[model samples]
Target: MINETELIEQLKRGDDTAFRTIVEQWQDMVYNTILGIVQNETEAEDLAQDVFIKVFEKIGTFKGDSKFSTWLYRIATTTALDHLRSRKRKKRSGFLQSLSGSGGEEKEQIPDFHHPGVSLDNKERAAVLFKAIDELPDNQKAAYTLHKLEGLSYRDVSEVLNTSVSAVESLMSRANQNLRKQLEEYYNKHYR
Candidate 1:
């Protein structure tokens, strides 16, 4: 296998085949990153494509300071985040979701349709839970999603969030406390 530096060199030289190679190499990781953010496979696919288009357009500026994969993941994360923010703006502006979500912080009973997980049932509660989560402050939701849902380590989460690791920890702590209170209220209302 050629080293990543060689791949970057080939890509910099403007070889279309090298670009295809980069796509084939990174698509799964790219797709997974977007899925973790949007929780929608269809949207994830489009976002991943957008990331690649960005990578192609900006490859010449890739400074070579970071590993290519790391650089790519950063691009993926930013693209996914931009897409998420756009969706949030749309949602709040009265766009009805075609597919439903539980909207709470508690893991939904059924496995994520796009991810493998322990099987469970009765996702309506999760939808209600998500509604509560959606009501949270933006920082809290972002901390919870990056730490809990994405399972990124504190350092990684900090890097993605552009905060110190201790700050990430504090944010996650507050997020958990807020989610617990919200979920408890949710449980009493529906499960009591």
Candidate 2:
């Protein structure tokens, strides 16, 4: 139950108990942030573990200019984005190999994602929304996830994203437009 400053100080001194406390406190937030981006439970779990490891190793680098949670959010988003990029690269290579007739693996597809935070009655709609989210560019996706999903304020999201508040606002506006277009398309295709 120590204050965050004390906990951070203990962590910097390599106190195992403090590390455990920090993980216990922030694990859910970290996991949920990653899950919003990656949209796969298994990958989100693995990336959450990786986020904690990064926190443990990089605790000294935390400057305390922003809230600890904001720093952690930055790490989680960066890790998830990196994993997504790596996955895309692998898929591209696999596609090239298939084109060359040296590999026969089928193209990978993004599965429908159900965010745990969604209510049971909304799971179907949430899955459709998440699929559209997955199509957004990375910055827009991160801004939308942090602001809309994680309930961060525009300024806090700007801090996590290392950008200006206006930039976050711009990202959000574009995200909303894109999501509306995508959802409208889905509606037309499925219900028309």
Model number with the top lDDT? 2
**Clash totals, every prediction:** 7, 0
Error of 1 at 155 (Å): 2.0
Q: Give the Å error, residue 133, model 1.
A: 6.0
Residue 72 of model 2 has an lDDT of: 96
lDDT of 2 by residue, 1-192 (tens): 599999999999999999999999999999999999989999999999999999999999998999999999999999999998998898888899999999756777767998888999999999999999999999999999998878999999999999999999999999999999999999999984
Query: Any idea what lDDT model 2 has?
Result: 0.93
The TM-score of predicted model 1 comes to 0.70
Candidate 2 minimal-lDDT segment of 10 residues: 103-112
* Model 2 ranges with Cα > 4 A deviation: none
Model 1 agreement with the true structure over 21-69: per-residue lDDT tens digits: 9999999878876665566778889999999999988999998875676
Candidate 2 to truth, TM: 0.96
User: Judged by lDDT against the true structure, how good is candidate 1?
Assistant: 0.72
